[model samples]
Target: MTTFTLEPQDNGRLQSLCGAFDEHLKLIEKEFNLNISRNNFTFTIKSNEENPKSHHEKLIQCAIKLIQDLYMETAPIKGKAKELELQNVHMALQERRMLSQVEPERAKSDVYSSVIKTKRGVIKPRGVNQVQYLHNILTHDISFGIGPAGTGKTFLAVAAAVEALERQEIRRVLLTRPAVEAGEKLGFLPGDLGQKIEPYLRPLYDALFEMLGFERVQKLMERNVIEIAPLAYMRGRTLNDSFIILDESQNTTVEQM
Candidate 1:
């Protein structure tokens, strides 16, 4: 166990540092397997093992450094302290290479240990590689899940997106794919943007409907909270605060990419 004090901490800064219900601190603790209790500016980090391994010590130091870095980032902005979001905390840790290098091998023994929670249920990785893939989705801004068909790659990706949306981590979910017709030649289709391209993006829709239910999905689509569009529709607009999925990327040309 060790104690560290963030110097000259202000109350507002502390709130931003800890996040809502100390969620940010909780994330750090989970990542490093440490218990953090705080008194104003002072914090105590307690590990489960009394005498932690050398790598564990290194992780502790890394956690402390990350806390210090995040604290530094909480400095007042134009006379007001900026609120630090979960994504901000994640970005800070990723910048330090903490998430990538610190996840231990033994963490994967339970395939369901690191799971994505959705309203429907928990999504578990089927194998070691899938476990790493889920972790990548967690710790990276964008991830590509490449695998053979029926390997849960597409389903898991959609599950993660649904979980993110349900958690309010993102404002919207936008799914897109190339619309190269395989066998059918439909001369004309009359409908909204999403309806026109529904066939091409049906797989993505199926996953969303399963997670969010049919009526809710329809309501979200009406509100533009969930969008289904062809890849060509993405050219002129910027997507922010949204989980965007580009499915069937193999069919895209260099220009489309």
Candidate 2:
């Protein structure tokens, strides 16, 4: 069991952080498989004791830190503590922790200070690795970002693609992913090729939607300025004047690449 208290907790900010009826806490608990109980500003997080240095413990700590950060910013709590926000919190915490373990000089460097412009606003890299990743994307013809889940790999890639398209740097944007199922058989799914494959490509669409807005993304798709498809669809085609993003490339076979 881990216990901590939030400092200078205003009732309104606390309410916003936890959401109405403690929905935010419940969401975090569900995701981390932990029990969270609150008594005013004090919070108790309990998890399986058999495993020391557990991921659940880390997640709980990150959640608490995120709550404190938001409280300090006086950010609106309503609709703020969603799955996406939690995911970002997890990523930020993971990056910060990892960077802290590395060389202090590298951790302090402002390499990722460049901002990526989008229709929504400027997208900045949250950490040193992300900064290097964006710099590579900008300078190199081909770049790869390989990392475990909860990192901003896909999100940053989509942001770069959107930025390029918006600046007229690329005539079109191509997003592709392998239509491979995890354990379930794809043959069991109903619908045509496009519909059946759409589920696999949803993450790309989601990132694009966040940066470009849904209506604008749809309009661009209609005009073929933005193209998304299964990797298999690109077999005989010659792509030109395009900023292409291949997500979930690990799921693709050798021939697909």
Candidate 3:
């Protein structure tokens, strides 16, 4: 790593800016793995060996801003300052980068590697009675989890899809719905069919997000790995090894069905 010198102006300004606490310099040094030495006015920073200077500079700026805006006068150099200082710096840098591109692959990889297996209450496992019905549908390649709205019909259906995905039983999950508003045609609604139906599809996503997390859902969407679309989009395609959830069955015509 190379050494860089900060002139009195930069050093004095930074020290004055972060002078509220003694540990602030240590926090920055550890986070970016740099060596910081200062004597009242002049400061020198040895660059981090692992991360490039660009990342280090951005991190430094982040620490300075956090110290200026957030540091409390009464609180000693507790760990909270370090935590907040690091979080602010990372968040600012993340916002400026193409965060999705960097993060999604890691998310997908992590989900695949995760071993903490247990049930979360967001979606219940289908009961024996419901499982039997789902089994018949899976065997026949067509079935419906039909009932009134409050029941676990849609949620269970999505859960089955997720289960299938986790088991490598399916290559994808496809969620679609009929878009028939009482007053407006699908065309008159703002965007294309997918856009028009997104609001309606949100409940499906909510269920998925609860079972999975925000990051997994976003990564899946980015890869075209999971889809929630208007029923019309399902036309002229043969789907294989995938879970298909078609909501609002009442709205579809026999031909569409």
Candidate 4:
């Protein structure tokens, strides 16, 4: 239901706005699979979705921003209100909507590179809270990653481990978790070591696989550079120089903790 009208202006300015938004609009269209209808400077969108309403408005705003940027480069312009075609605007918004859905996996791929790259600041600097806690771990040799998930505490720890190994600071990497059953009674399960432990440790394996590419992770496993095993096996072992990750700490009893 939104509308836009390009007012009378120098043909040069109109041409510049049109040219800039045209390709950008096309990219949006191809990515979002949307059709655009335009005449002179006017534009509109037609879509089958009920929520095409707000997306229509957003597309207009995006095209206007593109035009504003283009105009600033061509001829310095002060504050000027620009009207954008609804169809053109919708195209950009639809592309953006698609991008958001895949960003997390893309971010993980980027993080894997960051660890391998080992450039300064490749491992992002921790915030004040994380830095303070990490500093305590360095000073005290023990720290807890309490609080909710998605806070980057565990992931950052994994990153630090990778960084240390890449720097030759650690001889090996170790990861383990208590064999706590999710809900099914342990007695009812019918598998050996691999089957019983795998269910509880799959998350740790997934994190490792994400941080380290599959081939390298497999190579490390073969060379004993990386080890994922049951917590019981850790008993009576003296770890000299290694990176260790204890996942699912909440499931651990006081004796295990």
lDDT of 4 by residue, 113-220 (tens): 222223222333233345444444444556778767666666666666777787888899898877775454555667876567877676666666666767888999
Per-residue CA lDDT of model 3 for 1-257, tens digit only, reads 33333332343345433444745566556655666676554445656566565676755554443333333211222222222344443443343232224455642342222111112322222233344444554456778666776676776677767776877778999998887653446676698767877877778998888767788889998887798888888899888877888888778888996
lDDT accuracy of residue 196 in candidate 4: 76
Candidates 1 and 4 compared by TM-score, better number: 1
lDDT of 4 at 248: 67
The residue-by-residue lDDT of candidate 2 on 177-232, one tens digit each, is 87776554677669977778888777888998988889999999999999998887
lDDT of 1: 0.76
* Residue pairs with backbone overlap in model 1: none
Off-target runs (Cα >4 Å) in candidate 2 are 1-110
lDDT of 1 by residue, 1-257 (tens): 78899977688888889999999999999878888899989999878787787777777777887787677667665467767899988766554443344356554244324567665544556555676677777778989878776777777778888888988999998888876554544347677655666776778888988777899899999999998888888898888889888887776889988
Better of 1 and 3 by lDDT: 1
Best by TM-score: 2
Colliding pairs, model 4 = 59-89, 59-90, 60-89
lDDT of the structure predicted as candidate 2:
0.74
